[model samples]
Target: GAALRTLTEATTPALARRVAALVQEAVRLRPETAGQVAGCVDRRLEQGPTARPVLLPLVTGLLDGGPEQVRAALATVLAAAGTPASRPLRRELLESLLDRERDPAVLDAVLHAAAAQGDADMDRSGGGDMGRSGAGDPVEAPYRREDEIRGLVHRTGLLLVRTPEGATLLDRGLADLGRHVPGFAARMARWLTEAPDDWAGMVGPGARRTIENLAGVRVPA
Candidate 1:
């Protein structure tokens, strides 16, 4: 618990990453301690966005080879930290892992992580049915600041839709939100409606196609 606390409490990004590396090393050298390490990592992740950069390398590095328990724990951390605010970081980590991660359990965790952020947004908007009266109005939900919307669009263009696998995951993740959160699709549409022209310029053609084809997302024209 001390080590976990230290890992999470590290104030700087470099410190956090260093602590994660040490935990990875510990997990490597002592398989029996995987649970403790994972627990610590999970706790740090639950602390929210600040832990993401620290947790990113730990999740990606450990995914390739580790005790099953260790990998599963890392996957859980990844899913929790996988928010759009983390954006390209989360997408980058997941894309790399999905390409090579062969463990079914680990892969399942990756997919689950991908949807975590979108689900969070859905919940914040209230998880009512889409056709439900309160569901479709963006005014009813918490507003996303311009910077947040920019980050989301940036990820959509630069990372999530850059590859087939990422595009698929992005599409699926949002769709899941729409299904579970109701009116989430409309809310997303409203959010994007305010994206500045520069945000559109940030997106590439492939990403535009993915957004159009899969989510029918409206972008600044």
Candidate 2:
């Protein structure tokens, strides 16, 4: 409570940043403070650009080393702060974390965060096509977004499938991605089917079935 009060009353970006850093340290020392600290940070972010630069590093630091609760909280905060200007940074932050984060709960948060930001970005840009260029040419934004999502899926899928929860989270994330990105699920299914036999065999039956259901494909018995 004191932490949030301090953040709310902060007179400047520097002050807010300092308070946010202290809150991060508090979470480090007392994991139970994570929810409060995360709430404060989320509110700070609502102040917009000024608070974002200050809190971005704080969130990154927490995600890097804080306890599971803190990481998940910050991940959800990022998901909620899905403004167009923050999309690239948010995606990058989640992508970097997914590469090294192994805890299922944390992975769940990160995957959902990524999906939320991706969908928000697409929606703000006017759905899958992301609007057309002035010269009647297709805009490159959606293509870039597609590339970003493709990289995320390809990189995280194999690693996440190693555990049941990770596999399930990955499936759900893909389903979310498919809702906004045209044909993403079908493309992912193709990727899965085309993988080497060894790699395909590594995916458990439950994981495969979940993926198939979302992707609208049925593997033959």
Candidate 3:
């Protein structure tokens, strides 16, 4: 725990990565230390966005090369840190992980972390004057934001469909994202239909059926 705490104090990215490696080694040598390490990391992450810069290198280092348990733990830690103020950083970290992670458990944790961001426009619930027009009418800001999120979901789905394990988690994560962003599932269904060659052959029957059902797409007999 104490060793992991030193990650926050690391002055450079190199140093942070080194500290992260040490923590990983410690956890490996003393498996029981995993819980305590997670606790220490959680406390620092709870500091919110301010702690992101300091933690990013450490977290990235771990996610990049740590053991499965360590990677999963770090992903869960990022998910728990998900808040309106920290969503961007959390999304960035999780999405990056999505690109390279192959372990089913780690991917599951990353997907859950990404889904835990809730709605894309959630941060706008505070009613800021930033997106208003000269006539005090709402502009296309929210719709545009939703569109961006839809695109992100599409890209992420494409990545997830590349492997059977990832495909198994795809529908559930899409459902979670759809709960926050209306029409997301249907939109993704349309995307899949438009490009059948991209994912149709990659995912198994079970995942394809689940995705179709979730999106309300009919599979003709």
- Work out the TM-score per prediction: 0.42, 0.61, 0.58
Rank ordering of all candidates by TM-score, starting from the highest: 2, 3, 1
TM-score, cand. 3 vs. native: 0.58
Candidate 3 overall lDDT versus native: 0.60
The C-alpha lDDT values of all candidates are 0.52, 0.60, 0.60
lDDT of 3 by residue, 101-198 (tens): 77766656655544443333344445453476566766445555545444544555566666776776775565555455444556556656766665
Summarize candidate 1's per-residue lDDT along 110-201 as a digit string, tens digits: 54443354556556546543332444433322334323433543444344444556555455555555455434445445545665554443
Best by TM-score: 2
Model 2, poorest ten-residue lDDT window? 195-204
Name the regions of candidate 2 deviating beyond 4 angstroms.
Answer: 1-21, 24-53, 79-81, 95-100, 125-128, 132-140, 158-187, 190-203, 219-221
Kindly indicate the candidate among 1 and 3 with the higher lDDT.
3
Instruction: Decide which is better by TM-score, 2 or 3.
Output: 2
Point out the higher-scoring one by lDDT: 1 or 2. Answer: 2
